[model samples]
Target: MPHNLTKQPRRRHPQRSQYGLTLVELLVGIAIGLLLIVGATSLFLSNLDASRRLLLEARLNQNLRSAAELITRDLRRASYWDQAVPKMGSVDNNPHQGITLDGTSDISYQFDAPAGAASAAGFALTDDYRIRMTIGQTTQDLTDPAVAKVISFNIIESKNKIDIGMQKIPAATPNTECLTERRYDITIEAEAPSDANVKRRLETAVRVRNDRVGNCS
Candidate 1:
């Protein structure tokens, strides 16, 4: 018996296909990532700028307030005199009872020093748009130019008459002497040197403690 060997064909297994992204899909993904990064960077920059602006505005306000306070405090002490001095009748004939203004931005006044002598003090606006404070021979800037600029400084004086009852010498004449109450209105306007849009204005009224008795004319 001759055995015939029959060769059967080997079974072929189909290979699994590899999956990958197309060129259009890859480009679209990259574009989306870039857009997200750009948006984040822009948001950070905007917030940073806003913070800086707020800080600058606060500094500007502080500077302006300080300058205004200095001016008002000094002006209140314009006619201050020593209480130790002997009273010359009922009239306050103190020579340091007047405030002088140079018709512009300069104002000067005298006050009694600790040693019982008169001292000169003044506040002025310089050409460089800053407030300068002068005490005797010493001078200093009240406001920093880097922080703020003084746009205008003004001091207005007003007077009112009040009756002082009987005169010192009732026998000489029956006329009643009147006293003049002096008051000043101070106004200061300032702005940030770095940004003109940031500005502040302050106004204050001050009354002299010492009254001056005179003709009141």
Candidate 2:
């Protein structure tokens, strides 16, 4: 009993753990953040792709409209006056306008009749009045009737239907150039061989002027 010599052992306080994240926990949080960033980036890229397609379509439409307007304006006035160029293909072998679908199949504009005496077949004058456009590329000509669409052929005389084919029109005959005096309604189709099936169609009308009356004899 040495004055309670067996003093109670000193009471030890419980040690507290450090209140902070471990290295492993930090690495896991970083990984989660990276995943969120990648997800957001993917969404942005997808929207960009869609925007590009829409812009391309709009541009194409704009080009088509402008070109069509210009051509129709000229075509509608093809037979405007007497001082005008001869209404035969020979007089103005040059085409006024061209229609194309994707710039591939080209259809050009020409007065329906043999423009003049010099105009020949395969590019010749025919009694069958027809506004023709060469549909595809030609190694040689602008009026070679190639699967041409007749716009507004007025070859009807007393129940006789005028032929619109290349062989129908006459060369340098009488002054009654019937094709020029005749007004026609025409439609040209352009297609993309790759889904080109009638993708676009340009339509218009024109009357040939300075036409020799009664056509070639």
Per-model TM-score, in order, reads 0.79, 0.38
**Candidate 2 lDDT, tens digit per residue, 84-163?**
34554444433422211222222234333334422111121132322232322432322213222222222211112242
Instruction: Please report, in order, the local distance difference test score of every candidate based on alpha carbons.
Output: 0.80, 0.39
lDDT of candidate 2 at residue 179, scale 0 to 100: 32
Candidate 2's C-alpha runs over 4 A off are 1-18, 83-217
Give the alpha carbon lDDT tens digit for every residue of 1-217 in model 1: 3345565667998886857888999999999999999999999999998887788778877887787788878877886778526865644467787778887578899889888788899999998989899988999898889988889988788889898774655347556667888887888888888888778887877787776665433
lDDT of 2: 0.39
Pick the lDDT winner: 1
